[model samples]
Target: MTDSGEKESAESMLAEIEKKITDAFEIFDHEANKTVDVREIGTIVRSLGCCPSEGELHDMLAEIEEEEPTGYIRFEKFLPMMTHVLMERRYKPSPEDQLLRAFEVLDQDKKGCLSQEEITKYMTEEGEPFTQEEMDEFLSAAVDPDRGVVLYKDYVSLMAIEET
Candidate 1:
């Protein structure tokens, strides 16, 4: 193959690897949002990409922790690893259960569905508000007034679970 072809092959391989890593982390993040522990870190690491020992992950976390400016672990910093590790834990709630829980958390009303106004108000009151356009985009296709209310299952499945 020509030099350019070789370079393209390498780039393609890298892209594939990146996609795998991204998908793994995305799964992990979803599980972590539900809650997982530090002791289970090694398992999550293995599930995320390659298998690494618990001690290794612990050591890496220790180093990462020490180097942190705030002297504490931050969600943004360890999110990838943490999300991946926790995903391997078997106690994860089913998707349906997670959906129900999310609805319960966000619903704030016994109405059984979140309206655009409710979501917008919730985000605003929480301080990390979403823009009108962003909110619409996030809720689009997921919520349906025609259905009488946004189903909890649809809402959870529709929302992007990645670290934003």
Candidate 2:
């Protein structure tokens, strides 16, 4: 296929995945007695840059063995399911694990307390080739250090706070 054709194919797949995810979210929300408007679903799909079809979305949710008890979707279940859809094979760490991982990312120097510059630089490094604006928007302040940089202890503490 031509480069343009390949790009279009990829975009189409992404849209399909996003649609599936949104559909699953809607199904879960409906079961929860909540109404999921197209606007909200569209926002999620657009944010992720992908959409899944109805069948694919349900397949993704099948592992949970849940169906809308009230014949409608619930946000509670939908939220977790949506999270899974987005994360895919990425590790879903426990709270402690998440904190530790965040600490590892911020503590690039192996010394504690990540400086603002360190945090920014480390994030940029992780997402190589990302625009500055992308880095700014996605980088979490949870790892931002005070004074020199965030101490390892401080970074972990910040992560803990966010988890709670």
lDDT of each residue in 27-94, candidate 1, tens digit only = 54545553334434444455544334434556657754535344344345565444444444323334
TM-score of every candidate: 0.38, 0.33
RMSD of each: 13.3, 15.1
Name the Cα RMSD for model 1: 13.3
* Model 1 TM: 0.38
Q: Which stretches of candidate 1 lie over 4 Å from their true place?
A: 1-15, 19-99, 145-148, 160-164
Score residue 58 of candidate 2 by CA lDDT.
47
lDDT of 2 at 147: 52
Over the stretch 55-147, how does candidate 2's per-residue lDDT look in tens digits? Answer: 454464453333543333335555566655554732222455666777676576776566657667665676444458655653544434335
